[model samples]
Target: MSKRIQVTFTKEQWSMIEKFRGILGESDAELIRNIVLIWLSEKSIITTKIKKEMDDENGNRN
Candidate 1:
């Protein structure tokens, strides 16, 4: 299952995000998803399976 979210950012913050998005070649959704997944992984809130899946999606291996 998936959930939708609404986020509000200041103009400067949005500009930064836009800049990084362009440089990283990521769409808004992909950038936000990767950010959230990274946070979850850092906080140890995601399962090993999810971590593996995320790593695989990012073409990373450990």
Candidate 2:
């Protein structure tokens, strides 16, 4: 079973989403989901890089 979610967006936000959805020929939900997934993946990469940098800095201090 799929869970349902309710989100509220401002007029400008909705307008941007609609424009992208129309250009991509995707549903609102699909566009939103893709954006969310992409953002999450990017954040994960950033976090991993930060951790690695921290580890390298700590190792150099030894």
- For each candidate in turn, the TM-score is 0.53, 0.57
What digit string (tens of lDDT, one per residue) describes model 1 on residues 1-62?
Answer: 68888898899987877876855458887777777777887899998998799899899988
- Per lDDT, the best of the predicted structures is 1
The collision pairs in model 1 are none
Q: Write the per-residue lDDT of candidate 2 for residues 1-62, one digit (tens) a residue.
A: 57779889999998887877755458878888777766876778647666678778789532
Clash counts for the predictions, in order: 0, 0
| Candidate number of the best TM-score | 2
> Candidate 2 — which pairs collide?
none
- What stretches of model 1 exceed 4 Å from their correct place? 22-25, 49-62
The deviation in Å at residue 60 for candidate 2 is 39
lDDT of 2 at 13: 92
